[model samples]
Target: MANFNDSNVLSSTFYLTGIPGYEAAHCWISIPFCLLYLIGIVGNSTILHIIRTDSSLHEPMYYFLAMLSLTDMGMSLSTLPTVLRIFWFDANEMTFDACVTQMFFIHSLSLMESAVLLAMAFDRYVAICNPLRYATILTSRRIIHIGLVLLCRSTVLLPPLLIHLLWYPFCDSHKLSHSFCLQQDMIRLACADTTFNRMYGLALVIFLWGVDSLGIIMSYIFILRAMLSIASREERLKALNTCASHICAVLILYVPMIGLSMIHRFAKHSPPLVHILMANIYLLVPPVLNPIIYSVKTKQIRRRILQLLAPQRCFSTFK
Candidate 1:
């Protein structure tokens, strides 16, 4: 076991791992992964295109949806090159800088996604709880400001996380558990004490994800309270329906995220396949599912998609 005193750690080559015992099935595994990438990329790209072209989706809600789509696409593309390299071509070697760069983008985009979801929850809150002031509360300028703030928040805090890891000397076993780099996986290879890194990472997760999750929950609580105050049951139902897509989007992201975190923290002795599958699901499921969810639930988006697919039928059905 190499320790902190290892002088060659900075130049060490890190290799990504595929499924532990299924080396021969790597090609088969790539098939599902490839399909997922295809669906995620095309699905998110289509959402972005529709949102851009359709005038009806120019509201604050769809604007936030567009941000979600872009973040999903970024997450997908961030993992694509290395994932495919490992599973398809058996090429998994990465230089120190390359691994750090991938780690930065993956984690940053994830934080951005959390922030976007939080913003979307607020949008729903305003639209449902204060319908009259929705426009004023979430103006275009304010939305842009929120976007800028999210961008900065997601990107700014990541450098210290990655920079700290750079100073730690790695052990002889520079093998990463997943197809892509993660700070958790990277720190495990460090020869020095990683207590600080682990604690700092936990602090980040608590601060970023924990706070965003609480904000989302609080928004929904207010939304529910305002919803119940409606005199008519039908009105309450109608209001609840508007949030279904966002609720689904939230679950799609945070569920797998929590699962992966648990596996990393608690399930140390579990099968390697568990970690790989959970990690992939955490990254891929939301990007693929969010677009489908919104397209199905948002009548405007659905109508636009139907129009693109079958114009006459779309008019007849919607009319």
Candidate 2:
């Protein structure tokens, strides 16, 4: 064990924990993880393909959805190697730089997803609340600009946290709580003061997620108000229905995120399994479910998916 007192103890290797106390069941745990990865990759890829192939989906809403899928796929790919290594080959050791890189991609992609969701909420709000100005407000150039802004935001905000981390000398217990590197998990292994890291991380979360969440809520408030002004109940319901998929996607991402945050903040003494499970859910569930939710809730995407899946039947019916 490297001495915690020694400030010069810069550990080069970090061990990723699979499922604590379930070393014997690592193989079994990997089964579900593999399935989740498969579903996430295929589902998000299908959503992207559908959006690309259909000209009708060339609008701002589908463009944002495509961005969301790309973010999900990036997050999944970031963790896939380490996760499989730990579970399949029992290889848990990660080099310091490699771990930091993985942490960067995972968290950055997460922030990107949050931004995409916020943009989707704004898209719906404009469509329902200010239909006349929707096209002008969310032009293709503006959407592209939004995408670039989101990418820059996600990429730029994380390096300070990581660069500070690179200087911290890790203690003997360099074992990360999850199969992938997390800034929160990585900080706990440091021998030096992680106060800056923790505080800055919290601030980033609050700034990005908190502000995004507030924006989403405000958008929905306006949307509901707009819906109420419509004289026809059917029109109101129709307008509200358009938001269902985005709402589900938001919940899928935020609920697990909030749960994981609570677990890390307040339930530090919780079982390792609890932390691991919550982390997995936080990372994996959104990617797998978002595509399904959109396919089921959005008629255009659903019909496109169905037509893709059953071309002959769709063709026959159309004929």
Candidate 3:
């Protein structure tokens, strides 16, 4: 075990682990991961392109959805290189600074996703609960301000906590149990007392994930309440339908996150494959599914995609 007082800690390289008991299957496993990475990247890029080209998607709801797509792309890119390297070439080594950098982006982008989801929920609430004021409430300027605030909130609060990792002296067993770095998994490698790390991590989780989740739930509750006041069944259904994609997005984002947290904190003695599977699902599922869900559920986006795929057909139909 190394200590904080030691100089060697600054120069150490940490080893990353893949599916622990299935080293022989790494190449095979990389296949599915590669597919997911491609889908997430291309899908998110397509969403961004469509949003930018279509002037009709200039509203607050679509703008927030665009932010969500961007964050998902960011999260996938942050982990993709290291994950592929570990699976493809058996290269699992990362320097201290690199690990810290990965951890910061991975976790911060995750928090940003949560914040964006909350913003989307707010957009829905305004559209449903106060339809008359939706435009006034979520102006383009306000939306831009919200995005900047979310960006600042996610990027700013993390570094002060993560900077402490550099000060800790690590143990000889610097193996992190994933293809990429996580503050939780990496902090355990430190030989010094990680009481502060553990506590601060807990606070961070509660503050970010906990608060964002609660806000989303509250927004939905208000949405449901507003829907109930609408006497017509079809109108109520239509309103609820608008929220379905966002509801699916929220579920996909949070369910795996909760499972990963449970496995990390409570299932310490569980199989390594279980942890690895949950972690990968946590990282991979949302990026791949979010775009698909939105494209299917949101008619405007779906129509835009078709127009992009078959522009002559779109032009002929318009004629």
Candidate 4:
């Protein structure tokens, strides 16, 4: 409740917490967190490498999967350093500028992931509903354009908001509940009336993530309609099966996202561990699991990964 527009406040730094009230367990917690980071980085990187080398995977769906993998890699890399620092080394201090940068990357990557998932859903719809024209619809040039648009859309919207944040006066404790910086967490510490910040945050969520989710749901509706028209049940299942990995990816991303949002909004009274756990799940689960899901559900990716692991066993057929 003190005045924070003074010079001292301008230079103030925040200290991030690692599972509040569990300092003794921070080291223990770091093990699983580090493992998740390793899986996410290696798994997504392997996906990109396989996609790049496998000419057979040079299609729209795989192209979108590659984009998703790239986004997953970005998300993991963006958060890994701060997360490990907090849990492993107890280095929780973050300067304001650095915090803003981290927040921008985390939020921007999340929006980009939402856009990529929507794009993937559209790819599935085109592949299933109109296979004959799928190639024409999502050509390589068009896919590149879509990726650029998604990236640009996220890249452009956040800088102005972040700039606004950099100037806000902080009147509250500079301690954040999680290992990573987040716009919502940081803004709540501002002494200034953050009506605009709160509203813009809500609008951004609704316009970007909300619309992307709606687009995905609509695409699935059309896909379902197209599948139902097929007379053969097995054929319908096969067509739908193609989207299984994507469906799982969407669930993994959005389910935790929704849970995190709800926890921030309505569960302030709940135990700090609940919020910390949800935040970790949101930051860690998607990147770690997305590649695994795709490799398991998609036959081509699975076979290619297997071939990569055991080349001699597959050389007879793959070669």
**Candidate 2 colliding pairs:** none
For each of the candidates, the C-alpha root-mean-square deviation to the true structure, in angstroms, is 2.0, 1.9, 1.8, 1.8
lDDT of 4 by residue, 17-121 (tens): 888888889899788888889999999999999999999999989999999999999999999999888888889999987888899889999999999999999
Q: TM-score of the candidate numbered 3?
A: 0.96
Q: Write the per-residue lDDT of candidate 1 for residues 1-319, one digit (tens) a residue.
A: 4644464654468999988898899899899989988988988898888999988788899999999999999999999999889888999899999999999999999999999999999999999999999889999999999999999999998888788876787755888999999999988877778888898889999999999999999999999999989999999999999999999999999999999988888999998899999998999899889998998998888888889889998789778
Worst 10 residues of 3 by lDDT: 1-10
Which parts of model 1 are misplaced by more than 4 Å? 1-11, 315-319
Score each candidate by Cα lDDT. Answer: 0.91, 0.91, 0.91, 0.89
**Whole-model lDDT, model 3:** 0.91
lDDT by residue for model 3 over 1-319, one digit each (tens)?
A: 3444454654378899988877899999899999999999999999999999889899999899999999999999999999999889999999988989999999999999999999999999999999999999999999999999999988888887798877777755878888999998988777778888888888988998888999999999999999999999999999999999999999999999999988888999998889988999999999999999999999999888888899899878766
Candidate 2: global Cα-lDDT? 0.91
| Stretches > 4 Å off in candidate 4 | 1-11, 317-319
For candidate 4, report its TM-score.
0.96
Clashes of each: 0, 0, 0, 0
TM-score of each: 0.95, 0.96, 0.96, 0.96
Question: Which lDDT value does model 1 have at 157?
Answer: 86
Candidate 2 TM-score, C-alpha based: 0.96
